[model samples]
Target chain A: MSAQDEGRPIQSSTPDGAAAIGRHAIRTEALSKDFTLHLQGGLRIPVLRDVDLAVAPGECVALAGPSGAGKSTLMRCLYGNYGAGSGHVWVRHDGRDVDITNADAREVRAVRRDTLGYVSQFLRVIPRVPTQQIVAEPLMARGVPREDAMAHAAALLSRLNLPATLHGLPPATFSGGEQQRVNLARGFAPGYPVLLLDEPTASLDAANRDVVVALIAEAKRAGTAIIGIFHDTEVRDRVADRLYEVAPLQDAA
Target chain B: MSALLTAEGLHLHFGKVAALDDVALEIHPGEVVAIVGESGSGKTTLLRVLAGMMAPQAGQVLYAGEDVHAMGEAARRRLMRSDWGFVHQNPRDGLRLRVSAGGNVGERLMAAGARHYGDIRAEATEWLKRVEIDPARIDDMPLQFSGGMQQRLQIARTLVTRPKLVFMDEPTGGLDVSVQARLLDLIRALVAELGLAVLIVTHDIAAARLLAHRMLVMRRGQVVEQGLTDRVLDDPQHPYTQLLVSSVLAA
Candidate 1:
């Protein structure tokens, strides 16, 4: 059946059979985004084409593709950092459904704070914010108490094998792998049910890549659904239960 | 074989950390040598020292039978610009991201004061095609290409100048399996075609097996094992080398 003919707003209360299995996470249908590059004299280019994706509770889905294949763009669309031109992204929350694509800016911010988590390819940690404070940012945004959030962040950092000495220092000075662990800790800080990661292991070595994979498995055991874009197939093999490829963005006239 | 580059009793320190300790290496013309080490094992530091980017506290570096450290700055710079090509761990560091692919490939020639635009473009196109990138995209920015393509472009950039010695640091660090295979094949063919001597640093034993004529296994900034690739990788004697070989073999 056509998505429009269903007489619904392209929103699914739960992904197919996901709730029947005692969990519901993220669902999307015909989800697509088109970017307009405003070059000199106002020329526009359509970047992403129609793409469909879904993730179940505790499942890790990997997006694999070459550069300019719209993987990053799709991640931005799912995180609501960029508006989609057409489609719906539905997230199940406390026995109800919310269409993230249709939400207002404030509502989207709330969803991001309480229900969704995101990690981008290039981590932009705020300078001078201690590692604990950086990880606690998401929890603080959710109105959690500062002391409790800091404790939680500390525990996560230790579990991820970050040195205790790094707790009070800004993540900007940390190594690439350490910074990525901090980024993961921040994404998981608020107990969000759905997490999105973009190239989390791109700069890591073999040993550190193994560590990150173990963390993803830990997140899975906690029942957080994950969608990640990975450049390394070894990482994809270790973390993803399923894989999808993003086709190259079509050229515009 | 006559030695082209030699390091004797090299020592490097970063603060209190000993990155390389009494490391010795020798590279001969038309030979490919692979340095295999885990992270923090100082393979990169050794590369930098050989390339004259880093100074060692207690060592002598001989290039073409001359003491490289005793050379003046101008001579060293001349040697680097005219006789060496170094590829970094990340291709972006080796390339100018804002420039066109053709411009990147032709940069070394331009640096050596080649002013003919037609010759530069022709050489750039030839190298790009040799590296298997579409010539039509020669004008595209480095950022517009894929990671594998970018690495290939960087290889073209370095090799277009036809340097006698090339240094590559984990050239396949972040590439996919298929891309890595293709790139390794390209590098092998090009190195053979140019009769170029290579000093490659990599963590992947499989890559060393496929590319290097000789392999050196390092740990804690020391060469624990060194021999022909088959001899070293297949019959490693040191515990650390054994562990590394098993890990790669099992992987």
Candidate 2:
């Protein structure tokens, strides 16, 4: 069904300016994604069924489930990393709404660049790039000046307790905890209102997990809306203002 | 009753940073000793050193009264192959992800040159059953399993070889509350049943209380406290140990 059919009005404001004042950051209705896994010669498997979710401004929602529950797939769909077979994803900005699901490749790229921040279970860091540069890339992509972005990145690293000397070094040499902090910093660098995280603290120890939890709380306080997939109970208990579980979509056989 | 592993004044250095300093520990047969500490407290380094994965700059590791560090490469390899099982904080590190559940569990036997396919498959099934994984899913890939199931599979893989000494680094680190409890119970039961000596490194005092007979608390690469688990956790002597106990208790 179309978003209008589901009673969601078409928003008229831009998402980039939506953060200044509180607004619904993510709205979805009847969202669905399907993947065909060829079994033998002519079989297909539907990975995700019709799903609906919504996140208001400054909300933190936790998604939980077993390995094949499609939690990650749902996050991918929300962040425009994957296309939905049917449904609408709306991110409201400045009283206007962007239909992320129906956007073309270039439009989706623009939406992801300006409005969405994502962190996956395994962090991907570029070789030879300083932590500052890595964290600043999102802001740079959003058209923030290089110097200002670097300053913002440095401030974030310091707040996260990353060593000053290591700021210019490659993230590969940092400890697992430090690298995760960098990934988080990059996700928040552009100040996007919507953040998507997948098992952010699964690889970290207790102390490091606490640090990331505190960061998530801080982000919410700063008015960022977060939707994350978590396997750690402590993290979900500590951070989730709301929680949902993704179950396997029934087969069409 | 014999000392299966011993460390004397173990010192490890990562560049200029001292990771372990004058550390000493001992593991005897059928005993479970837990090392408890905060992150960056050298607990993992100590375990790696004892497992012979890292060399100590000054100090000695003795395996059954022989200097393990001094052993020839072939002998050391043989000792590791026959006597030791090490579990990483992340099960993915301990498991072969691309392979099926059966292959992951059967590999240790295969590495030891157990070529009988029937025997390997039978042994893998037995181990999987031991770890509470359904035998019906033995052909599935590791990627298809849940977090707790993957960890159970890792345990099955490591224990299939029936090594005498098992070193587990945060075996329950990433599991959910109920899953962690179950996995801990499984480990405790299996350790008792097999009379396996375990040296587990963990930060959770509650887990240590449940699984360990003895406990060591480390800080800044030094062992601040070591004693029976109840004594150390109930009435910690060292300030660092006390802090750790209280922190976990508070949680």
Candidate 3:
């Protein structure tokens, strides 16, 4: 699916001049990204091209595509994890649209703190940190009092069906499914304006998957604009409002 | 908000090394701004220059619209004892070891022209209680106190004058982890309660996150990144900031 296949016409206007981000929580304009694999004989891998994606408040837009179709690449670009080779990734922050592609470090940091959030597939476990603290850190970083943050963390953990006994222990030795729950709890507790979840329930059981679906529904109801990559079609159908297909590039070096 | 203290085009050099390189900052009234970086990043040097202790080869520090470096020695000393307070990393550097805790707190009051002995002693006793030290220990010398107690006492002495701006250099540097935690909590509470404008320098990212509303991440004597505290710690943009955040033992 090219940029036009999504029913949005190609925009030739300056990507930085103005943005329609007041209504939409996030949007990209003619955004293109490529990676130059230096070790592989300077091979240029074009992952995404002329991508125009947008999500409105209280909506959940899921990225749909086959494996290696650049879905995750697009997700990363939206979150400012990957630099856009050309065009702008405009994110609404502090009541203005900021292009993360050209934004300075400070601007990007400000956008991420209150406006955007991302939950990677795997938990980046810090050695010796309790599971509850791991989940509570994002809240604490946002200036929430420690006690309140911990209480909120504990509440989210329990909602995910994580046993109370395991809350005090680190997730380093936990099963993949358990760690995924921890990651989900951490990402969801802060209640960001926009969120990105990549394969959020890949390792979860059917029961836990249902809990995740409910969480997504609640977030959407609370006015959170979410962009997620859900390989599980059933889970995707339950939560997604629409699908944005990312087609693979034909010119691969 | 108007800034309480502003430094512009700060530059300093030690032999061949640039300890402070064209650094600039603004701290508003009742706001906490922290300078954070690894050792030898020039955060401490920047603090000293801002406090009027060390004159930068270039740049000017303005406090309430007056140039800090342009003031005479005597006027600067007078300013330091009254409107400004500095908390050194070592308590001994900030306190008089021979003086009793009460006397140390009272000395600043006396310097500020509170000559009545009764009022000075009463205020000192109140401050001891505020810092969580027993009021009865007011007569004890700083040497008799533990490390954490000494640090608390140092804080009490500095804050006794109700300085409009306070400069802290690693206030929890040498303490145990538990002690550091307590000190941080106390600092946070006191800073909020008094609405004191603070410029704290620390290598501890967690401490900075807990106390400062804004932070400057320095590297090689330059401000590589700076922004809201949560933003810098969460999604660090500069490569040096990312390395610094990753180096910490995450809690």
Tell me, by lDDT, which candidate is best: 3
Every prediction: chain A TM-score: 0.83, 0.83, 0.90
Q: Which ten residues in a row have the lowest lDDT in candidate 2 chain B?
A: B230-239
TM-score, prediction 1: 0.50
Residue runs of model 1 more than 4 Å from their true location after superposition: A1-253, B249-251
Tens digit per residue, CA lDDT, model 3, A97-199: 8777667544565577788989999786435568998898778767899999999999999999998999999898999999999999999999999999999
lDDT of 1 by residue, A226-250 (tens): 9999888888998899988887765
Q: Tens digits of per-residue lDDT for model 2 on B106-172? A: 8889987799999999999999899899999999999899999999999998888889999999999
Displacement of the residue A236 alpha carbon in candidate 3, Å: 3.5
| lDDT for model 3 | 0.85
Measured over the true interface residues after superposition, the C-alpha RMSD of each candidate is 28.7, 28.5, 12.2
Measured by TM-score, how close is model 2 to the native structure? 0.49
Q: How would you encode candidate 3's per-residue C-alpha lDDT over B1-251 as one tens digit per residue?
A: 56799999999999999999888888887778899998999999999999999999999999999999998889899998998999999999999999999999999999999999999999999999998999989999999999999999999999999999999999999999878877887787688667798999999888898788778888778887776665567655565776687789966
- The number of the candidate with the highest DockQ is 3
The C-alpha lDDT values of all candidates are 0.78, 0.78, 0.85
True lDDT of residue B106, candidate 2: 86
